[model samples]
Target chain A: MSTLRTLGSAAGAAAVVGGLVLVATPATAADTATVSVLHGIPNTPVDVYANGERLIDDFQPGTLTDALTLPAGAYDLAIFPADAPDGSGEPLLEADDVAVPAGANATVVAHLEEDGSPTLTPFVNDASPVAAGQARVTVRHTAAAPAVDVRAGGTPVVEGLTNPDEATLTVPASTITADVTLAGTDTVAIGPADLTLAEGTSTIVYAWGNGEAGYDLAVQTISGMHSMPAGVPGGSAGLADDTSSLPMVAALSVAGLAVAGAGVARVARNRG
Target chain B: MRPAAASAVLGLALAVGAPTAWALTRPEPAAGIPVEQALPAPAAPAGAGDLPALPTVTARDAAPAAAVAAPAPARISVPAWGVDAPVDAVGIAADGQMELPDDVSRVGWYRFGPAPGADGSAVLAGHVDDREQGTGALYPLKDAAVGDEVTVTDAAGTATRWRVVSRQVITKQALPLDRLFARDGAPRLTLITCGGPFLPEFRSYRDNVVVVAEPVP
Candidate 1:
């Protein structure tokens, strides 16, 4: 319980300034997934690679994640230091043969050992997929779960699942609309997902992270997120609009000041 | 006078070219204080039941730093939200973050909240401690109830009053989202802090209790 509270506090701090946090949702036909992953390693950047391509590179530990939509299938995942295959100057820790069933959301764990050997584990649901629209998918902990490893489509997205207990990943878009095939239980374990991405069109993954602290935190969170229609460019844009008009006004004011100064000087010269 | 003379010289030279706008180098910090001073706590909010009292000074130690160093806060009073505090003037931090007063034993302005005339809710956050190991201002903020009062006097310019209407403690997983902090109602103020249970080993609060108030008529 104290651990939960400590984790909660840490989660709160990250949520305040870090970025978005995804929780689990019930798996339904039209369900969105809430994918959350955490790189257990602290202060270091970890590159999350899936299908042999870097999804989130140099992702600051503790807060890299995404909520994705998928029809589901087998995929590959890898974990390495940001300056991978060289910087960490080591071999890749691979969590291959990851099979996410149709419509159901799966959570994988990627833990890098002291020696940099990364391990991946899976939690597959058994329930059948819904017949259409949005379904709720919950991602939770397994009896022996290590940490959280999240991916979007076929790419590795989020990591460091500190508290999947309260968050869920929003499932991304998939081609099919019916129920998703599951691996085990009918109910998803985490929470609920938000937003539904269109399947046909290629979509980039974004993460709502709490622990990622650095430059790409914003972009990682945005790129790792499941693009919700409204969450897209709105409030910040409004603020930008207000400030965008400032430079021009400041320019005009300065120009006016200069012109007035020129006029006064001319009048003085005339008097002279 | 010297500034005007310099301006005259520059103005005459500008006629020979498309002059660049004057860009002043950002200001630096005063001595004896950290560039990012800790957030301070405001006086007890109005309508709030007699607040838990804090250690009082003899008004002796507050010299030098109180006068030319910083803009004194205007008297602040909130009838509905239980705030009758004063606000001091402050400059933006060197890093561009809002710089609250270094005293964290009380509720202080969060500088990042809604700026003056912002359409949505504004923010003001402070600490409940005066030290890493001691409790200070806002220590009892989690005890603040809904409908209390919170007023912020922009001593640099005007005195704006705010009323407390809601108070909640949310875990980080469930952040007080844009809906709570940036509401569509009258311009409001939401105060945040890490409170509830103390995780001593972690040196942090377990939950963030948010106290929300709005402008009263």
Candidate 2:
């Protein structure tokens, strides 16, 4: 649990600067696409190849790669065992002539099918701006498990989610306790874990692994869709004005002190 | 001058005693998994893949270096104004407004925005004056002159310096939020506090004193 918390902090910190977005350079927007890779095939540490060239080496299960800015085009993609001498041998998974659209933000996953066979799935990510103070959370079911319901803070947000399928919701920014249960049943399958939905960002959670191996969660965050606050209400009293009356200041001073004393007392009460 | 001194005294007392009251009210820390470490070379080698043509990947102008994550800012100091205070992370309120700390002494750093040293505008706001706290730590921000330096220290104890570039007291309705809370641009530091006349009906100041600063080389 602590390890997950630490990892969360590290990832959160990395995107804290106004939410990092996988943006295509404006000048080349018509020619480029942004892509990230997630290796969710449990028990397999493999090398990822694109067009017969190794793009990632010894890629571990449940690991997600940083975004790559690639020119928009079609290419053969393959995955091979880590110890494979070259791309000449039969690949564990292969997809031919995968068309990558220009200016697209996508995630390609190597994961298990509903029947527990390994396969590849590409999903177009939602990067549109979310409402102010709200966050977008997308959940993808890539595990071999049966259909399930995803509950946030004890309320089911995604129902009857199936293998290689996804559900998305925009919610308030907060830390919520989330769990997955067998569809329409109280039987918990995974988690009662905490998920933080930060404002203006889209968080994609992947439920991966097979029924035989046990399921785990992986996360990918894309930021930069934040909206401005309606306003900043910074002051209440009229004390900052130069013409403030002496008698009012004196009166407020006493009141302020009393409030300060009460605050300290409240802290003491909380501590006790 | 007398009113300012009286308010300063009131501010000092609240600054010393008020942080604990609001600390208990903040939400829990959120969670995320560690970002993946392996990065592919920007482009595939020419003629490597069976495709119509060799596709090359290039670096994004707006993306930060994915390898090293910058730390969050923990404190801020403006020696010119004798302003130094701890910062608390804050987000948007349910009302679709920026949530300010209940404690007037501590500044609120907009968590969803860029951090102080990151490549965008980093916003730090404080109350100008409140009923419980007579004056805020950023009350002197309106008086900040161009060339004054504001220093922010991150969690790792690295202090980044910013030089005051401009100051403005615009009406609250006309606040240039897009520029002040920008997510993409050169690194900048933005300071905000209440100013102008306070309205009894609204219980808010009419204007916001905004200070913009650029990174100091």
Candidate 3:
């Protein structure tokens, strides 16, 4: 769970960011991990810092950065209001000791929790190839909403998912109508929207924004994880026929005979 | 000299030399495994007494009840080609070409593609032969017929089956790059190797033999 605290004023934000700086390292370095940062807090543009170094300036709300390769480790991240005088104010939100693992592809989101408190949420993306004709859907609760049930085609597919948590399912690919309802209640909190689950893709849906202030949705797609049943090279061969290359054929024949001779020698040596 | 003696000498020559010819006609193995491992093992003497048989064991049957999850593929078998080879995950090389398997006796599974049992096209590629190792595990793919069975076994020992549907010989220069490397489509398995006329000038085969198969649901 993410830690959240209320601040008295913008000036007090700096004290909060300075209070935590845990020096922790990661366990392994087997593979490089890729990470993308998403800013989901409405109307907020932020300057992002990692380990006291400026990573992104003027990171706008509702936008996501391209995946960046990062070594597996723990990182300290802080977000300050855009254009704030350097080191003169507190960060709007800060998270320390975020653990990123090897071979992982993930997104670190700066979004508001239910009740409009800003927080950081880390999501691990599953990029493993999906079975044929199937698509994977993951719903993340990152909005200012209470625990909710996610419905796909009017049936409850994920139950009691609370803020900052997620649920995933692998189903046959299709366009599905999805909606979110408050837990134990049928009242729609957001959506009745159409989501296309393309074959061999993972469609991640984020329920963001403050519910009391009117909740909304954001979708991200990750693809290229599919398995074909057989191997067949597809495409057209440019040449009209094999006859255009006769000299090359002669060269191949000579090469073949030479190899045949060598094979005999090797076999005879092995026997002796 | 006896006819049998003459034939034996000829066969041996072909066995040793064929690998070099094939190697000259195909792309070299990508830098993944050691060069020696990529070469085929030498044939044993013909008159050696029958080797003792090992006990048969099935990984799936012996697995614990808690280990039923689908496992990552570890090996591939194309019965039609008498190929039972190890499988290694391969990534794109710095030159942007798909990296090939380090061992000629093994097949390289494109890491970017879905695992074999997953939906979409899973691609596996191998060398036709090696410069020092004759007849790689996938060498027999050139003669694979439609409806041949291909099996991929996962680390957990679960085996998924596929049946060959089509085979094509396309010039390398004209290969439909996009379609050949598609990530999403009907679940299919594609096997690739060098084929068609060998071009000495280019030191590569002019065409590629592509085999397409579908899950045997």
Candidate 4:
């Protein structure tokens, strides 16, 4: 989960067990708990974790969602940025003692800020489908919270509501997928609009970036927009991997050492 | 000159300072909120056996072992279990991971773990149990006696054996940072493994039973 891995030659700690991509081994019995991440973060290094393990590490901001495999149990969920949870990255958005039961889904949304703290909210939305090349996005902050500036690409598109509970973004018909942004700080690549707009599809809208740490960003596609994924990409809707459970220092040191061990120990001006 | 010896091994139940709780985070921009709350209190996590063994590991993945021919650091003999695996000087992998010789998989020695005979706390680690594949050298560590002879080799190539003073079944979560990392400064060796009746469902041993060996010679 260290950036040094990206620069130097450090083999990813990603261990491929038995030749299988060691993805999250969800709880045996499908728990009713479903957790989704919607962040109002721009240009962030994702570090999402569940049950205290390094699951996702998208250490570069982009809007997306990823599902997790966990046994139904009480979990302490958190989100942070790459390179730090200690002042270097955003503050953690944690839901203490969240219970995930079998066959149920648990949805938790995190909003990011430049100050690096969190104001989390439990986002609830029904599945609505959207069509390809055409998009319908909705965002709202619960209980008259902060205002967030939403951007379509790098340009400002929609402003998050403070007391103005609902906001929406409709992409042009000639679009493939657009990057969704929260506030001015968070941005993510969202949607490969599927089907025809006239052919309405269901997309479950989950927005979470409108609070103190206000900017929980997520997508709410027109129902059935293309084959709607079980959840957003990049692991848990907008829940960028932003937790301290993953070691950044240890990883950086390992990478530096790997380079030094490779007979390049004299790369003076080394910055870990 | 070598540092002066501190307390006798038996008398030293090394008191390692509580490790500082380091908050882990990524390199993303903060979502824009103030963090006024003190970090959640550090916790010694439980339910370790339930955790998976580092998704995967090398059987003897301690690659590019340092100075292998340098005779075993000290003689490690688990009298009751009948193990007499010789300790050797190990080093970091080419990748910088603590690596033991691939030739001697599951053998324990104090690399950066603990020192052999110094004023500081030392460590000893061995494979919990192994044969050719299933079990290797530290196979009998599960049943080692209270007073088993565990010799540690000094940097000068002298052997200093210790007695297995205590055995503990510590979950991986509550790994004793002080004892394993040795911040308090005492010489010791911590034998380790994923052992106890092997759990088929879990695909690993019950807990890592550590045998703290103190210098006797």
What is the TM-score of each predicted model, taking all chains together?
0.27, 0.66, 0.46, 0.28
Sort by DockQ, best first: what order?
2, 3, 1, 4
Candidate 3 local lDDT, residue A88: 52
DockQ of 2: 0.16
In angstroms, the error of model 2 at A99 is 2.1
Question: All models: lDDT?
Answer: 0.38, 0.72, 0.65, 0.40
Q: What are the interface RMSDs of all the models?
A: 28.0, 18.0, 22.6, 29.9
Q: Local error of candidate 3 at B77, Å?
A: 33
Better of 1 and 3 by DockQ: 3
What TM-score does chain A of each model score against the native chain A? Answer: 0.33, 0.75, 0.70, 0.40
Runs in model 1 lying further than 4 Å from the true structure: A1-272, B1-102, B106-113, B130-133, B180-185
Q: Worst lDDT window (10 residues) for model 4 chain A?
A: A229-238
True contacts kept of each: 0.01, 0.35, 0.03, 0.00
Instruction: Quote the lDDT for A8 in model 2.
Output: 23
Give lDDT tens digits, candidate 1, residues A200-259.
122222222222221111111212111111110001011111123445656655675686
Chain B only, TM-score of each candidate: 0.50, 0.69, 0.66, 0.53
Model 2 residue A234 lDDT score? 88
Residue B50 C-alpha lDDT in model 2: 40
Q: Please give the distance, in angstroms, between residue A206's alpha carbon in candidate 2 and its true position after superposition.
A: 1.4
Candidate 3 chain A: 10-residue stretch with minimal lDDT: A3-12
lDDT of 2 by residue, B1-217 (tens): 3444455556557554344434454222211111011111123323213433433332122111122335778899999999998888888777877888878888988887889978778889988878987888888876877788999998889999998877777788887777677776577888888887677798887888777787899
- On residues A1-272, what C-alpha lDDT tens digit does candidate 4 reach at each position? 12311211111111111111111224333433334444444444556655565445653332434433344556554566666653344335444454445433333444432233344444333233343223454444432234555443455556543422445555433222223343555644222122221222323333333233333334333232332111100011111122322355445445544443433322222322
* Candidate topping DockQ: 2
Candidate 1's DockQ is 0.02
